[model samples]
Target chain A: MLEIKNLHVKLEEEDKVILKGVNLTVETGKVHAIMGPNGSGKSTLSYVLSGRDGYEVTDGSALLEGEELLEMEPEERAAAGLFLAFQYPVEIPGVGNMTFLRTALNAQRKARGQDELSAGEFLKVVREKAKTLKIDADMLKRPVNVGFSGGEKKRNEILQMAMLEPKMCILDETDSGLDVDAMRLVADGVNALRDAGRSFLVITHYQRLLDHIKPDVVHIMADGRIIQTGGPELALEVEQNGYADILKAHGLTEAV
Target chain B: MGAAVQKSTLEARLEGLSTTGFAPAARKDALARLVAMGLPGRRDEYWRWTNPADFIAATPVPAQAFDDSDEAPVFEATDRVKLVFVDGVFDADASDDLALAGVEITRLAEAPDLNWASGLYGTLEVAGQTPVARPLAALNTAAATDGLLIRATAKAEKPINLIYIHRSEVSDPILHHVIRLEEGAELTILENGPAGARFNKVMEVDVAKGARFHHVRVQGRDHERRAATAIFARVAEEALFKSFTLTVNGVLTRNECVIDMVGDDAVAHVAGAALGDGASDAFLHDDTVFVTHGAERGESRQVFKKVLKHGAVGTFQGKILVKPGAQKTDGYQISQSLLLDDDSQFLAKPELEIYADDVKCSHGSTTGAIDETALFYLRSRGVPMEEARGLLVLSFLADAIDEIEDEGLRDDIVGRLEAWLNRHRD
Candidate 1:
């Protein structure tokens, strides 16, 4: 459902290339995990695919179901069934979380030429989805992520992904700030949204998140490129042995 | 003692007023004050940010009514006793019978000789003309033709709504209103509509001991209108005084509020929300507020917010004064503006004068564009760019609108603000 070929992206304001000659694809119903250390161009790939500003995509193309995703605006990407769970969700002071979610959901619906949900209908759906994620009424009422614990923010992001029901989801380091319990909870939220038509690109530094969400394909990314690709066992191999041997085998020295 | 000064065009306009009818004494004193101060020039300290010359210039700009769709003025949804004024004259035929219980409303033109109102005609304006000069208010007092004299003996059964309609294209309306809330009395005064092409209004309020007064005003909607309005209030012992003003659009608008907390343990709050879009080249909105904590344990707050876009200008001049021996006084003043784009501008002057060692007074002013991160976050969630901008703009004004104590009234004001945003969004 999602494809990336020879993608090259660089910081727009700086003379540095973050993604170089990267190629990846996640078929429908597949969960792809990209494991790499810090500055491995993992998050850059997510941001580029999500159409974030400040990135100059010099070469290659990202496609979603045969549609050119890179040419679309950030909001257009969202309406095109693309979702990115931000590594750090922004806190909007006066915008209630529930209101933000409803606006987003309806905006996407309107962009897709679908009827918008009434207030009552939206509230009912939000309550049901929030309950499954263990997000209480209070968390849904406060300004988006303001004063929320790190884990609550992650959960809120998951709730949004579920509400929007995007076809391709990108979790950018979703487990970085989460504790073991919070990681499990977030993974469970993502698991509940899994279906035959949905796909996930889970980016992380560690393999513990994969243990919970269970990726179908594992790719080891280093130095701005995916160096290796394997099945689920590849995550355990890196977790047990670390990336040092893998780097040596690839004839590259450790970054540090 | 000295020879009478020469008159400028604005001064000549004031000089031509027919003083044969109203309180000639008050008009004479006010006219002298205006002449002494002369219309505030751009060089003057207070007028540096907002000039009255364009508003008070002779041969006023030819009036052209802004064609807003027919909509009910705010408070039309509420049960209020409506008093209509058209072209500065009281419209008795369109107004409700002045029979509100616990409240007495008299036309200033009919009762010009009444001692109660004449005593207060220019009292607050004169009292506030210390330290700084408000020559335009003095001009309004000297030239005003008609307004209301309201007195509340007990709790008013319903709010008194003053609706000003501008039917004349070239009308230059000057009006002054005097309101006195007796001891233990309570009243709510609601004013709305664009009065005329060029409007000058002054409202003086006296809240007696233990009285409660609420004043909510929504300025005219005409984008080409020019207005200079003042609300001067004095709070007595244990009384409560609150006032809020909302301005949508105008060529030039200067709203000055001077409040004195003269009674022990009294509370006073004055707030305003102004929205000026690209309605005209010189769309200017100014709010100049001076709040005084005179007695012991007095509390005062001034909250003003402005949203400007498309080269529009917004200005705020606010001060809080804590008098000596006014121990335990608490005062707060904040003026903020959201400039939607690169062209819009916001000018603010905030000051604090505290003579009491035991008082807590703070003032702050901030001007900034909408948060881009917040904007992107909303847009990323699928909200359109314009709708996202609108949401953030309204959120910025929510704090100032919250100063309105009544929920229904606050909602009414928010609705008006939303309507303005919908029309002006780029």
Candidate 2:
């Protein structure tokens, strides 16, 4: 469902490189987990796939369903069924959460040449999805993410992912800033939306999140490149021993 | 004075007024006051950000009216006694009869005597001359041809709406209105439309003890007209006075509001929302306010928001003053602007003066472009860039818009703001 070939990215304003010669592929109906330590370009990969600015893609291509994703605008990529659940949801003051969701949904629908949802139709779907996430009507009525608790923000992100229903969903550090209960709720929300036509790219720093949303394949990423690919057991191995064993096994030393 | 100050072109034009129906003493006093304070020069501290040259010119450059058929003036959807004015002259044929229980309304042209409004006709305007010179308002008081005289003895059954329509290409309109709310009375006043090519207007209000007054005004819709308006109000003991103004840009528009809380426990709030997106030379919108807390334990708030795009300019000069004996006075003032483009400009001057030791007064002013992080978030969620920009702009002005007391009127004003945003959004 998503393909990346020799993807190289760097900060546009500086001389630093983030992702260097990275390649990954996720097939239909499959879930892939990329576990990496801080500054290993995990979030950068997600941002590059979702078409964020401030990064120059110096080389290679990222395609969604064989269409060049990097060439499309962010909104266009969204219309093309690419969704990125941010690590930190932005707080938009004075913009009601429900209003933002409705606008976003209708905008995507219109961009894809589909009929837009009516207010009532959108409200019904939003309420139903919000209920499972434990988001009350008050949270939907308040400004987006403004004064929201960390768990509430994560749930809000999950609610958006459910509403958009994209072909490729990238959860970038969604487990960060979440307690065990919040993580369970978020995992439940994501698991409920799992379908054959949709794929998931779960990017994380720890193996705990992978336990809740078990990945079909686990890739241990270090220094912007995938060093190993294994099954669900690899996550438990990392959780028990940390990235030191993996780096050593790959004939590399951890930074002092 | 060794050398007489040269009469400005505007003053020369006022010199030709017949003043036939005006009270001689009042007109003379007002004209002398205007002459003493010559038209605010560009170098004047108050006029530094907003130039008065174009508005005070003898022959204002005429502008073709904008076609606003898709958007109706606020309050057109509500039922009220409409006081219509065309080219500064009262239009009786197109207006509802000035008939409402507990309220007495009169046209200034029809009432030639010193009249019930004598005490307030130009008193507030003259009193406002102290910290700075507002020569345009003084001129309006001197040469205004017609306006309304409203008196509310009890709760007004219906809101009084003053609708000004511009029909002539080269019209210059001057009007001064006086409003008095008796003790225990309640009233709401609504004003809308473009008065003329060059318009000068003044509204003086007196809210008595325990009275309540609500004012909502939507300034001219013409993009090229130059307008100067002032609101001078005095709130007495336990009275409540709240006023909100929504302005769309003209070539030059300046609105000065002066409010004095004279009686203990009185409350006053003055707010404005202005949008100016000059496609050509930048349109200018200015809100100048001076609020004084004179009595003990009074409260006053001043909020102003402006949205400027495509090289447009917005300015705010607001001050909150607490008298020496006005202990425990509470005052808050904030002015903010959203600059849509790099060429657009926002200039604000916020001041606070508290002589009373126990008073609490805070004032703030800010100017910024849209939040890029928030914009990206919205766009990533599939909202188009333009729509996202519009939403943020509206949100930037929401706090000030919420100051409107009437829900229906607030909705209508918000609709007008949305329409403006849609037209200007790229």
Candidate 3:
């Protein structure tokens, strides 16, 4: 569902390389987990794939299905079914959450040459999707992410993912600020969206999130490269023993 | 001295004026005040940021009337008493029947000698001139040819819509409006359109004890049109006064608002939202506001915001004053601007003066570009760049837009802003 080859990235404003010679692929309907310590280019990879600014791709290419994702604008990439759940959801004052979601859904549909949903149709669907995430009517009516608790914000992100139904989804530390109950709720939401046509790339610092939405494969990333690729047991192994064993075994301790 | 000052600046500007509105005594007094104050000049402290050369010149710059009819007229869907004016001339044929007015309304040109408005006209303008001078408002009071004189003794059933339509390329129009609300009365005034190539307008409102007044105005349509507008309002005991203005597309514009809370517990709020793009015509918009709290427990708020791009310029000067005996006064003022590009400029001056130490007053001004993180967040959610920027701009202007007390009017203003954004897409 997603492919990357030797993806090298650097800061656009300075001479700082973030992602160096990184490559990964996620097959259709599968969940892949990328675990790493701080400053290990995991979040940077997610940002680069989402077409965020301030990062220059020195070399390499990322493709969604067969289309080159790097050449497209962020919105175009989104229309092509790539979604990134941010670590910190932006707080946009004066823009209602419902308005933002409706606009995004209709915009994506319009870009794909599909019919736009009517207001009534949109309201009904949004209400249904928001219910499972435990988001009430007031939260939907309020401004996007403004005054929202950590649990509410994470749930809102899952609601968005459900509504857009992207082909490839990237969860960037979605569990960092969430409590245990909130994390389980978020995992349940993601687990519900697990279908044969969707792929997940879970980026995290702990294996707690994986315990809920179980990954098919886990890759240990360090020093801008993926040095270890294994199954779900690998995440437990890293959680039990820190990235030190993996870094030293790969002779990346000095780089760390 | 008055004659000498008038001849120096307004020699040719007032060559063909023979407009007599209200009583002779009031008109004569306004003329005398205007002549004494004289036309504003570049050296004047109030006109330092805006060049009054074009306004002082003998002839106005010519502009072709814009003929776009793609969008519906503002407030067209709402029910209102329509009063149409073409280049300062009241169009009797286009206006509705006077018998159908929801409130007591009279034309300034046809008002009787002992008219109710004659006693109130220019009263607030004169009172607003203590700390700073507004010579243009005095000029409108003295020289306006025609306007509407509105008085609401009870809650008005419908709003009064003042529709100014521009047709002449070189038309320079001056208009004066006077409004009065008796005790416990209520009224809402809606004004819109580009009056002419050059326009000068003044509105004076006296909100009596327990009365309420709401005002919403939209300025622009002609890119080359230039305008100078001023609103002076006086709020009495427990009265409520709220006003909001939306400005777009004009080349040079200045809006001055002065509000005085004269009686205890009175409340007043004045806000403005402006959008300027200099890709075609130069854009300059200045909002200068002063709010004074003179009675105990009075509250006043001044909120102004502007979005400028492509070398456009925005300026804001806002002040709040709490008089000595005005204890427990609550005053809040904020002026902000979003410059979309390096060439755009935002200038702000915010002031607070409180004689009563117990009063609560705060004033702040800010200027910056769009929040990049927020912009990216929107785009990442599938909104296109232009659409995302428009959303952020609307959000930035939302606070000021909310000052409009009516829901339908607020939606109409939002529609107008959205249309402007679409037309000026990056």
Candidate 4:
């Protein structure tokens, strides 16, 4: 359902290239895990796909169900069924979380020519989703992410993803800064949303989150390029043996 | 109606004042001081943001005669005891003399004696020191005919509301009110400007030790009327004073507030919201002085918010002063404005003066259009642009309106604000 062909991205000010000919494709009903060390351009890929400003797409293209996703605005991309669970959610003071979420949801609905939901109906749906996600109703009343703890912010991100219900979801370092319990809870939330005709790309540094979601395909990336692709057992192999041995075996340690 | 005419006519009228009062000596001295000051011009430091002389010069109408019409108040169903004043004169028939446990409500002219009147009159006069030497104040003192005086004795448990309603027709009317809350006493005063009338009014409040005073003023005059009012408050040791002014209408409106935190451990919060539109020019100037005379732990805060649309102009100027040896003083002032239309304009200046080293003081001012993200967010939620703008503006002014302690008064002001928004919404 989602495809990225030789996607290349570079910073505008400098000659530094962040993504180098990265290629990935995920069909319906499958979860793809992209495991990478630091500086492997995982988060950058998420930003570019989500249409965040200031990221220049030098070459290649990204498509969601055969529709061009790169040309849309950040909000438009969100409406086009592309969701990026941000690593760091922006804190908007004086804007309540429910107010923000309702705005986003209704904006997408209105763009698609759908009838808007009443406040009562919207609150009902939100409360049900929030209960399953272990989010308190009071948190929805507060200003978005202001004074929220690290784990709470991440949970908020998942809650937003569930509310938006995009066709393709990209989770960037969702496991970072989460305890073992929070990690399992978040994994469970993601697993529940996974279904036929919907796809997910879970990006993480550790194999702990992978144990719960159980991806079908695993890819290891280094130096802005994907170098290895294997089954789920490949994750445990890399967990026991670090990336150095894998790079040495692939002859990519000295290729650069 | 224009700036030039407003300025010239006000000048001519001030030049023609024939001063007469019970305190003729003080009135004459104040008039001479006003003449020397000669209606603050743009060149003056304090009047830079809003020039009353210029506004008065254009629409120079004579002092209005008393209108005894039984015009009902816009805010009905108020629970607090009411004292209404019509056309600068006290309305005895429209008010109730409630024998509350610990309050006193009486007219200034009918006080049997002039003891309190003599002491409270001219208390807020600048005495030729500052540029805001009270030209309109002098006009009120010389021509006020009558006013209301509500006093709360020391440690009074109950609070009273003094309501002033202006009713005028062909001329501009003025009213002067003085409220004194003695030591440990508490009172809440609600003042509403008359609709469809030109009003120039002044009110002075003196708060004593450990006393608490709450004042809420709502100006909802018709767009054709012009209104100018000044509020002066003096706070004593361990006393708490709060004042809120909401201006939602009038062709030309200027509501100025001066708060003096004179005693140690005295706290004061002064806030206002000015919503203007349709060729209206609403100016709000807040001059607060935190005098820390050996009274440590004095605190003061002021916030002013203005929302302008349809070529309206809103101006806010706030100043906080910390005197020498007034250590441990905390003072903060912020003024923000939201302009809805390209033709609308907002000017803000926040000033802080500190003579002591151990004082914490900061002042900030910002003027801009509504947040585009917030606007788009609301519009995307099926709310029309005008309604969305109104909601945002309401939230913007909520910071100031929320300071009012009385729920009735707060809701009254909010209702007036909504009415103003509905009138100006496109």
List of chain B TM-scores, one per candidate: 0.95, 0.96, 0.96, 0.85
Which wins on TM-score, candidate 3 or candidate 4? 3
Q: Candidate 4 chain A: worst 10 consecutive residues by lDDT?
A: A247-256
Give the fraction of true interface contacts kept by model 1: 0.54
Interface RMSD per candidate: 1.4, 0.9, 0.7, 5.6
Where does the lowest 10-residue lDDT sum fall in candidate 4 chain B? B284-293
Clashing pairs in 2: none
Worst 10 residues of 2 chain A by lDDT: A247-256
**Tens digit per residue, CA lDDT, model 3, B1-426:** 455554556657667865364566767787788778888988987788888877777778987777658889889878988899998899989998654334788888887563787578778888988899888887787788878888899898888899888999988898888888999999888898888888899998999999999999988767987899999999999999999999987889999999999999999999999999999989999999999999999989999999999989999988898889999999999999998899999888888888998898888899988899898888888999999999999889989998998888999999999899999987
lDDT of 4 by residue, A1-256 (tens): 8898898999777888999988888888889999877887888888788775557889988989998888876666777787877676656555578977886787778767888889999999999988888989889988778788877888888888788788888998998989988888888788889999789999988898899989999999876778888989989987988677887776756332
The runs of at least 3 residues in candidate 3 whose Cα sits more than 4 Å from the true structure, single-residue gaps closed, are: A254-256, B1-7, B19-21, B100-102
Q: Could you give the DockQ of candidate 4?
A: 0.12
Candidate 1 achieves a global lDDT of 0.88
Q: What digit string (tens of lDDT, one per residue) describes model 2 on residues B298-394? A: 9899999988888888999999989899999999999999888898899999998889999888888898999988888888888888999988987
Top candidate on TM-score is 3
Instruction: List, residue by residue over A1-256, the lDDT tens digit for candidate 2.
Output: 9998998899999998988888889999999999977778899999888878799999989999999999998899999999999999999877889989999999999999999999999999999999999999999999999999999999999999999999999999999999999999999999999999999999998999998999999988877778888998988888889889889888867755
Cα RMSD (angstroms) for every candidate in the order listed:
2.9, 2.5, 2.3, 6.3
Task: Judging by lDDT, tell me the better candidate of 2 and 3.
Answer: 3
TM-score (chain B) for candidate 1 is 0.95
lDDT of prediction 4 = 0.71
DockQ of 1: 0.59
